[model samples]
Target: MMAAQVPGFYMKNESRRVKIPFIDSNSLVIIPVSVNGSEPINFLFDTGVKSNIFFSKTIADELGMQYTRKLNLVGADGQTVLSASVSPNNHFDLGEIEGIYQAALVLDEDFLELEKVIGIPIYGVVGHEFFKSNPVKIDYDNAEVTIYRSSALKWKPFGFRSMPMELIGNKPYVNTTIRQIEGPEIPAKLLIDTGANHGLLLNRETTDEIVLPPLTLETDLGRSLGGDLFGLVGRVRRVEMQGLKFRGVITSYPDQTEFSDVIIETGRQGSIGAELLNRIKIIFDYPRERVLLKKGAKFSEQFDYDMSGLMIRVLSAENKRFYVSQVRENSPASLQGVQLYDEIVAINKVPAYFWELADITNLFRSEEGRVITLEILRGTGTEEEAPEKLRISFVLKKQL
Candidate 1:
């Protein structure tokens, strides 16, 4: 059952839990949230951010939020500059808990690029401060998230592996060991980030465990709040955690030259995100300095990647639309005439508007030799000129 909307405050009923189902998009936890009683929209449950961040100023305007001040923030180590406005106050609901955040920051960027990469609508991101006074439990297998009051909760692990975490400026860090095939395990520190959807990102600046496997693919990993975090994707022979071992784990390494050092200075070797975490059910107990993990159904599942060499994002101005923002060179998409800025108006003869970005993206990840039919609209439609619409078909091929 969806969480029932409640008013005011209620005393803690430790036994009572509000369960909110979540979508695992690119290892990022996307949850439905209603801000200021508005219609439910997708929000990234992120612990990496310092405060609650609304992706667009239009969101603040639509909510009738009054601005407190304006500030300039550097993101991704000066890769992209953010112009942000502070909202005086805001109320949002995550599961059954209602949170009131003060001085919420809304960015000028629409973050449609981010949605394109993740293939979902991410209206905003709620960070540490949003739940600083509360506790959250995340069950990856069941896709349920529970939020509890900090004072009314008592946590006891039942057969779950518990790891002691160190909180530095609101982020959790833990130590783990990673190894290449037949190599000795190398100890490394990783930040537990629920916001990231990718499995493992080893900072070449910090650790030397990021060795590209025999087979690797050059792809645009994902965009950061600062800018593009591009890198190569491959697999490591094994990764050891607490007393468990994950073999042949897919890993990614961001080109230090293209990324910023802000992540490295987090004082960890690298970061662990949803992809790996999804293998286990996790509880992020911030107030208690502990993270509980239990193996989940996905623990043994192999990690598959986007077979089509295309990066798509959405446009929400008039209606929701998906477009090809980037295409890999010499890949199946580029070989089949897919181009930058090509509007994906339809798929399999169905109107593109009929499908969500997630659906369109999933089609791109089909097994090799799978054929996909897409309707493409090229050029802009004008009063005298109409955009060229072309029907294109391509077979999905694994690049790696």
Candidate 2:
């Protein structure tokens, strides 16, 4: 059922919408947007957030936005909370879509700086408030997002399964089943968070019925408003959705203590993020209380992760070098003597300066058992003085 009217945004034709190009960086959707005629900025097109948020205080202050007061925000991660100021009257444009946000939060810290970890610029985030007015389509295959007025949506497409969703605090939650190897199917409620990068994230408590895979590895999932999210990564034997069974799906379970009280109150098992949603065409129909899904080309592709046991980050774009942000103990990279803060000058003889962070990360995920030769520079003293360069070879092996 369509609401009487969606506030905030209006369409010129009401029947046609335009597709905006987006960068799918490290599984996060970064869309270009502008606020109050400011230069275009990248905002995370996150379905998990409730309100529009500008993460940079500098940006907020420069805009001359008035703040009502400060409030503490608890995140879905359950562990992190942010103290932010509530500002009103924010007008933003996303291609042909434009809207006025009566109130938006601005964090004191440049949460957008987190984008640097992935080598991108994400100034803010647009969430439920932006989508509430119209139907939105995310075509991951073509890396484009399309906005449709309620009238333009067909509502139902062939070969798609529709499931009712419960809107909790402006985020969508769905009840689904995850099959265990020996026990009955585990019924769980999960959030549809395009902002999250993982395929499946279950609170540690939800895995009692479903046994954990034989192989699991300690990994740093990502950052949350609270802190860095660290967890054990593994695979679920099967996840059945709409009569379709996805086997050997990669999954993560964060510590129970990390989640906030509100998340626990909602009894949310975990979240289904872009990693899984990208395998299927998904429609988030909040007003109708339903979500639709159709299989995508990558539906059958194997779930993969970085096999090098090394988490790398771009240290300097001008220098074209990457620094080891983290090294998993006992992993291939660890076994090969890769250490934290080690600069990567080249990979397999190709200068690291010539490769983008995404491509370099992909190279590390190449076929398991493949040999990767990394040229490393140790130490962080004066850069003018040449540092020691060492060649270390490691075989790409699955950690979990």
Candidate 3:
């Protein structure tokens, strides 16, 4: 059930637990969030979140919030969303916790929902932005999460470090660092985005906010996780998690702004994206209010990438349905004229069947420069005089 909206303070009920959904972190209870100088307000514990977001506009207009100008948002999907600023005070009377917080006003928005009732019109989404350095622990069985300040334990299996990020209207925002493909690093306090598929998404207009070096790479457009935003793709100079930094050659993009549900206006300027993937073992701790990225066992061959511009899916001939989705651009599949929506009828003279997408791509990405034959049922020809089981041979390429 969704969390029931509670206005006044209530003692923690030992008998029942509430469930709420958050990105970076998935689901947790709605415990009271106490500010330095205000009443203890309710907050949903979310691990899916990479930062914090408090909608100042909703608070001011609906809840009578005080002060500020336009706000900006840095989202994890690698987009910069700017907004008019506002004071976080009117959003909630967090008493003593009212510090100089950056925020944006918001209307009804969503990130993810693991709730059905016990609903809440979120004033803000709080996440890892609260703590950066170490890993925070969440005891869902016990209904609590712990963050260690100063002294940290040494027994961590994955030494992942997460950085605190700020969000506006639910998306993360930050200054930015867009590294040129060659030479020097362009300083950008970009977003810590997980909601994006590729690494870095940059725009000359927004990325130029921070002084950067000359860019040498060509970029293009990319799709957002929610398909809500189009982002510029290019490489980042460096992506840092806590003090552990990874540098050099990465891909990013440019142009077009992003509008996300999870990335709210809470003062941050940029969102973090794919630059942090596979490179580190991610302990995306939402309950701990931090995203811990650990250096995990790296396979030397794992990073060896070759694209065969074919997004393929496995299907059961009998079921007449697909079970895979692997699309690579500029690949043999593209050269051989394999359309995206093609229905596969056979594989190597046999009626092919697959249970998962992984199974298809495993066969597709494999055998580079090797000839593979496929049989397809391309739509219809009259009634159903046996849908043609095509046999076409093609070679796979290493570039996409």
Candidate 4:
């Protein structure tokens, strides 16, 4: 579907650029946005999607927004379709900038469950609508997004590499090369997906040259609106674009059966997500059909995977309580008796509440052979019976 013809304007006519701060949670960008004069709400700023999507129908209803039509929304897995109502002619206020007569899709059900997964209240996602009319620069180190007016801004190439991008179906795709552990360099067309948290994703069905590495770990890649996406995690020898290279990059290979049915853009092989993008400062110049990139502060940091093998979720609205949502079999966490639904009370004697979800995730990805201690409360606590509290310690190990 085409993106809505929503034009965004600055609050002040003389303003040429506006900086909007964002929260980098799990490598995903979250920004505060107010819709139709409502209070500021947390929204995911995603380049992977074309439309603004509201997961809560109640929020739209409370704002007294009118639905103009019904739309069928497809999940990332391609098979699951959900019903949605399109609310047209809505106003959006993104701090210093505002868009009038914007279109938004309100889903009938809260299928993503992003709040539990990200440990933050993410109401929806805003994508092409906000990016189509401007040159948006993402400063990863500063945690801010600078939106420049296409008409007023002058392009400069100072220390930045410019790469041509293809605008297809309201999404941006770029060409690059990937070197697998055992093969020659393979040409690839990857989507610039800021919404995805992983470093890279390769669809093995895309080409014969794109093969899984010799070593791979079977794991749950992530959740799509359809359901849990199972995949393999491995490392590529190198991935290079425009003379910039990243070595030993972690890559995800979603099962072909899970994504094959989905109609992808022509010649699209995979996607470059935020985990890798976070290592560089990026400018999405959609108006000119190009992307500008420069090295970021953490450019030289090595890519790491989760060594704990525990998928955690926030069980409280405040994002303080943590629980083990999934435990990979035969991994360190599972081997150490970390089971699903185990409420993590403390880590290394430090209260789990004192740690943010990002901090915990980073700790698990810190390094292999690192020792971790956890005190967890398992089972339900009844009036007469109390839940069992146990301490489990494990050494992190690299599975792949």
**Top lDDT model:** 4
Candidate 2 vs candidate 4, TM-score winner: 4
Question: Where does candidate 4 stray beyond 4 Å?
Answer: 1-6, 9-11, 152-154, 258-265
User: On residues 82-113, what C-alpha lDDT tens digit does candidate 3 reach at each position?
Assistant: 35444443223223222134233442233322
**lDDT of candidates 1 onward, in order:** 0.73, 0.77, 0.41, 0.85
User: RMSD in angstroms, candidate 3?
Assistant: 11.6
lDDT of 3: 0.41
Which residues of candidate 1, in runs, are more than 4 Å off?
A: 1-16, 23-27, 36-41, 61-64, 111-113, 149-155, 181-184, 257-259, 317-320, 383-385
**Tens digit per residue, CA lDDT, model 2, 301-345:** 888888999988877655666889999998899998999999988
Ranking by TM-score: 4, 2, 1, 3
Best by TM-score: 4
TM-score of 3: 0.49
Assess candidate 2 and give its TM-score to the true structure. 0.91
lDDT of 4 by residue, 256-370 (tens): 7645644343679899999899999999998888999899998999998889989888898495999998898899999989999999999999998798888899899888888
Error of 1 at 260 (Å): 3.5
Question: How does residue 151 of candidate 3 score in lDDT?
Answer: 36
Q: After superposition on all CA atoms, how large is the RMSD of candidate 2? A: 2.9
Could you arrange the candidates by lDDT from highest to lowest?
Answer: 4, 2, 1, 3
The model with the greater lDDT, 1 or 2, is 2
